[model samples]
Target: MDGVTIIDHPLVQHKLTIMRSKDTSTASFRRLLREISTLLCYEVTRDLELTMETIETPLMEIQAPKLEGKKLVFASILRAGNGLLEGMLDLVPSARVAHIGVYRDHETLEAIEYYFKAPEDVVNRLVIVVDPMLATGNSSIASIDKLKERGARNIRFLCLLAAPEGIRNFQEAHPDVPIYTASVDSHLNEKGYIVPGLGDAGDRMYGTK
Candidate 1:
């Protein structure tokens, strides 16, 4: 828990409860995911640097705070990560986007990368990698590995839910990148699914599987 931040806002918790219900419809689940994602995005970027710039008001000139340095890069881990990506973009419209296509091999739970695209200027900009569940940490860790290989120095990981095993694995693999999530569930089931989780986030969101 040393490098994890949980977003416990009332609205976030309320929506997450609904999302956890098996009775929830796909449309409702998708809507709640987008709404909760916006709230989570707010907490993840809370410490962004700020600079002051002079601006003219209707009657006089004033200095206003503005974000400093390059715009943020939201590196989505493909498919399910895009669920969080949509709402994050709603909050930070100017943030750059990166797509890393990686999937878990159901049998081995190993991450396989088939596609990757990111801004050429990822050297100094902050990159936040997103996925709905961190059950095994394989995909998240592999995605960050690709980002770092491309010269990304400052990075963070964001997810809707995380398992203790996944968190420990992620921390051991990439301690430098902090994690943000709405909840750290009890544990992962034998099939690599988060116990009591809202099922497959990607499937629930898109009505797939």
Candidate 2:
């Protein structure tokens, strides 16, 4: 809770509810994720520093506030993270994108990274990591670790849903990175699934098992 922000906007809540329903089709779920991500981006970027710039309007010149920092970088955690990435990009088209591919080793339940690619100047940008679900926190933590290894200092984690266990682990692992989610679910089930969550977010969105 210290470094986490739960986005409870009306539109975000409503869309989350629909995503939780078992009857919701894959296409609908994907569409809702994209829509909800736009709202999440709004909150995440609320405190960005702005600078006044002189600009010419039809009749006169005026100073207008504009973002005054390096371009943002959206670091997505593999296939599922892409769902949130697409929508966030819709809102901030200029933001750069980084892809981190990690998966849990079924037996060991350990996160293994197969691929990682980030912007060349990650140190100068605000890196926002996107993932649909924060369950065990293994993948999320590993992704951030990779980003930090690549010179990223300013980072934030964004997800559609989160579990108490996952949040605790993430906060403990990276206290500086703030987390944003639509809902913090009851808890994670035995198999590492968030209880009352929208099933497997990647599977639901992409129709994979």
Candidate 3:
């Protein structure tokens, strides 16, 4: 509640509720994810610093504020993050994108990084790590580790939902980075999934499961 932002905006919360319902169709689920992502993205990038410059308006000369520094680099945590990326991009169209893939071993439960790609000038840009569900936090922490190795230090995380265990794990591992989420549900189930979560995000988004 204090450190993490739980966005319960009417639109965001409403869309998320629809996403949680079993009756919601796959098409509806997909559309809601994109809408929620767009809604959440507004708050995430609201604080971007700006610089002033003189511009000529139709009426008269005016001062305008332009965003400062290198553009944002959105880091999508493989599949689920991709769902969130489209919405974020609608907000920051010029931001660069990065993809990182990690899959957990069903038996061991540890995350394995399968692929990683980052922008060439990632060090100078703001890295926004996005994943729809933050369960266990192993993938997020591992992704951050890889990003840091490649010169990304300033990072913020965005997720559609999260679990307490995942947030705790992430904060302990990387205290500097702040996490943004639509909701933080109860806890992880025995199978390492968030309880009452919208279910496997990758499968839901792709109709795979």
Give each model's whole-structure lDDT: 0.94, 0.93, 0.90
lDDT of 3 by residue, 1-209 (tens): 54688888899988998898878888888888988999988988889999999999999998899999999999999888999999889888999999999877877778899999999888899999999989999999999999999998899999988999999999998988899999999999998999888898878888888
Deviation from native of the Cα of residue 99 in model 3, angstroms = 0.6
In model 3, pairs of residues that clash are none
> How do the predictions measure up, each by TM-score?
0.99, 0.98, 0.97
Tens digits of lDDT, candidate 1, 155-177: 99999999999999999999999
> For model 2, how does the per-residue alpha-carbon lDDT over 72-156 read when each residue is reduced to its tens digit?
9999998899999999999999999999999977667579999999889999999999999999999999999999999999999
Clashes of each: 0, 0, 0
TM-score of 3: 0.97
TM-score quality measure for candidate 2: 0.98
* lDDT of model number 3: 0.90
Sort the predicted structures by TM-score, highest score first.
Answer: 1, 2, 3
Model 1 poorest ten-residue lDDT run: 189-198
lDDT of 1 at 189: 89
- The candidate 3 region of ten consecutive residues with least summed lDDT is 1-10
